[model samples]
Target: MKNAIEISHLTKSYGKNRGVIDVTLNIKEGDIFGFLGPNGAGKSTTIRSILGFLKFDSGNIKVLGMDSVKDHVNILKNVGYMPSEAWFYNSMKVAEAIKYAADVRGLDCGEEAEKLCKRLKLDTNKRIKELSLGNRKKVSIVCAMQHKPKLFIFDEPTSGLDPLIQKKFFELINEYVSDGATCLLSTHVLSEVNKYCKNAAIMREGRLALLDSPDIDDDTFLKFYYDEEDL
Candidate 1:
């Protein structure tokens, strides 16, 4: 199968000694890939680089067979992204924000947007400033999934979500995957990795610490998880 994402010695620095270092990995098409890392471990840095939000110092990144930097606009056309923190025009209604996202992509969302909003229990008429943290996250989810893009990149997607909503969120993910989509879930939750991901990569201190399948025995995976933590 063709790779969905390819990072070759990807490096991004932030003066002094901060940022990702020599990261390389390949995520296959239609795979639910997990990116496990603690906060400040460069997971977001790598993701931002992939989305062309940050310029890397060296190395290369390819998404869906297109150069991340040179073809970022094209790549985005097929990718859905939910940031760890949701930020929208606080003065606008939730529906307006969702509409704006669809308008930018120039794709009619149709009933898909309404279906997601209903499942997530997000009130579209509510002003963005009135929603709670969880509700705001629900809005983000709808905006990200409404287009039903080929690839979905969710950074810490479950935070602020309740257990019930989280379950529904993953269900929606599975639903999308069955339609031949790919997902890259960036999170620190090991259980989520074990339950949802086929392959997983762990990051530490701005570098790749381990890359393995989560379907491995729990004992073996825990050993690797702790070993990396002790480093």
Candidate 2:
């Protein structure tokens, strides 16, 4: 088994503000890894660093056997990212937005986009500004999955989505993983972690609080969250 993502002694700070501190982790290819953390716990910070969107203070991050910074563009080509808050050109239609995402990867994703849109119940004819939060999330899902990238980095991906759509989304992810893709799922939904994740990590105060299987007991999590020393 190969590691799809590797981080060693990774640290990042936002001036005097807090960020991730000496975080280290590895996810094997084809694994569905869950990232759990309260708001402001640095889950997004660590993810941003992995995508080379933020400059870290020290340490190294490798994705797909390549340096995160030096191979940023190449890494992007194989990554399918769906942010919690998907941003789009308000003036463009949803179909156009998906096309723009496909263009960025230099791939023709028409067939996949259509399939995902149908499964997600997304309206391709709607303008970006006309869509609600859930609709926007659906658009993001289409954009991310259309190209069928090797790796998925989803940050709070299920937010704003209805129960049916959320179920469909996970089904699609399962299909992707079965095809040998890897995923990094960052979210606050513990139920999802328990159901879909093989391995999980929790963060607190910009530091790792626990690293274990997703089937963590409630008491154990409560103890760990109250104070890292308790764990």
Clashing pairs in 1: none
C-alpha lDDT values of all predictions: 0.90, 0.92
Tell me the TM-score of model 1.
0.94
Q: What ranges in model 2 sit over 4 Å off?
A: 224-231
Cα RMSD of predicted structure 1: 2.1
lDDT of 1 at 59: 95
List model 1 lDDT by residue over 67-140, tens digit each.
Answer: 99899999999999999999899999999999999999998895899999989888899999999888899999
TM agreement with the true structure for every prediction: 0.94, 0.96
The ten-residue window of minimal lDDT in model 1 covers: 220-229
Name the regions of candidate 1 deviating beyond 4 angstroms: 215-231
